[model samples]
Target: MSDIRPGGPVFAPEEVETPPKEVSKSSKPASLWTDAWRDLRRRPIFIASCCIIAVLVVMAIWPSLFSSIDPFNARTCELATARQLPSAGHPFGRDNLGCDLYARTIYGAANSLVIGISTSVFAAIIGGLLGLIAGFFGGATDTVASRITEIFFAIPSILGALLIGSTFRGSGLGIWLVVISLTLLGWPMTFRIMRAAVITAKSQDFVIAARALGAGSARIMFRHLLPNALAPVIVVATINLGGFIAAEAALSYLGVGVQPPEISWGLMIADAQRRFLEAPLPLIFPAVFLSVTVLAFIMLGDAVRDALDPKLR
Candidate 1:
């Protein structure tokens, strides 16, 4: 078409000018973690689980904030008030030993949180490191590590914990005994996951490029492979934290974990089991709290897993 105007010079087809093209600046693409965070924000399950965990963490840290009674003090108990139902003062009532059930439940949060968090952290560290080294190096190192992991993996976690707890009974190891037991049994699963992740990630283009660029073994393994491999490990760890809490409770209930002078949900349940026929409040309260806490963690893990895995989304 011609650019024709009454008072302007007519331009030839070759002389006609076209407007410059506008270059739109594209925004950076969202990363996997960024997408997951955005997804989690919209999930009701994630929000609810987080709230429950926050409250439980606070209860673990400051039991006195929730309950005024001295839960740890057995001296304050009176057999006259033993096995009483929930009253105005004690929402969960008194245990068989006349100890405040509410206060014990509040205090019990600390032990469970401690065991769960500590075991998860220790297990992840040991397993992640071993898996990284084995997967990155691959050969005899991988063979030996896999062999060791298989040996441990072959044993059921709860059974191993039961055997360890039973064997070390009366050794005065205290809560650390449970922590150690769980950590030892828990690492194999984490190791296997991390090793598989590393094996997959190391073969990716980015890692091969990094290796070609002369990155060191440690650098390639941690700087490149670890971040990619960590998502599944984190999901597993979150779920295992809940499982560890339940395992501790079972061990405690069986009289092989968290002895007297150190109150845990399991210990309280064990004490209450004898008097359950007369007053179920003692067993009911602690058991309910334990169940809720475990359920919350498991829910949180499921939400996180769903958010993090693109396939699930």
Candidate 2:
């Protein structure tokens, strides 16, 4: 006891490390779509594509917002003003008939986007519902649906459209005819994808649990099954939407799509083809717009697909 020479305490409180609180098991996990949205936000491709698509959608809804030139005003043309090349005042040049190529091209976007989006949505809804019913119930329903989808798959959509377009006689209804024709053929692919998705989703543990809880078929399908099965369908629908727009152009070039004065890119391209050697800008401009629009949709679809797919993640 007499050996404590420094008059200081030898021991200090030992530093104690606190353990981290464990995550509670009762907390809900992030859903697939939630994770997908988070992943999409980090992707540059998704962002760029979304921007491009948004601009295009705005252009489609209100083309006058982009260009002040009247697309359908043929009286603005003169013999001397026809087939002029691109310049400062009239960028994108004048068409064979002297209409403003720039304005016409901008306006044409509306028709393409409307038909594409409308057709795909219609096909997806009708086909998805049928596929869901077939896949969920199985047996005779499945057999019939499978047969119908296969039959449609055997026929090329363009060929079917050509045949149907030729048979249908109408002046101003060419665009509607093309939409109808695409819907008829477009549904099969959507149906096949949806049927597969539904079959997989219906067998999941959550669906079984819902069944055990005595949920009816309609409730289980709408509340549980449809949400899970929608990702692939959405991707397919998005990708197919671009194809439908391109198809509208093709049909128009063939003289069966949106008629004169309606202002479609395909119609513009068709008019410029003959005079391509003299004024290539008119053709080039519309083609470029169409390419960019379709590419944007496809890229958007691909980004969405990658984000939604758990395997990819």
| Whole-model lDDT per candidate | 0.89, 0.88
lDDT of 2 at 226: 90
RMSD, each candidate, Å? 3.8, 5.5
Cα lDDT of model 1 overall? 0.89
Structure candidate 2, residue pairs in collision: none
Candidate 2 steric clashes = 0
Q: Give a tens-digit lDDT track for model 2, residues 106-180.
A: 899989988999899999998899888998999999999899889999999988888888788474575788889
Model 1 lowest lDDT segment of ten:
7-16
TM-score, one value per model: 0.91, 0.90
Q: Please, what are the lDDT tens digits per residue for candidate 1 over residues 1-313?
A: 5657788777655766899987767866899899999999999999999999999999999898998888667686878998888889878878887888888899998998899889998999899889988988899999999999999988998889989999998788889999999999999889989999999998899988998999998888778899999999999899888989999999898878889889898888898898788999988988999999999999998998999999999
In TM-score terms, candidate 2 sits at 0.90
Scored against the true structure, residue 295 in model 2 reaches a CA lDDT of: 93
Task: Name the candidate that leads on TM-score.
Answer: 1
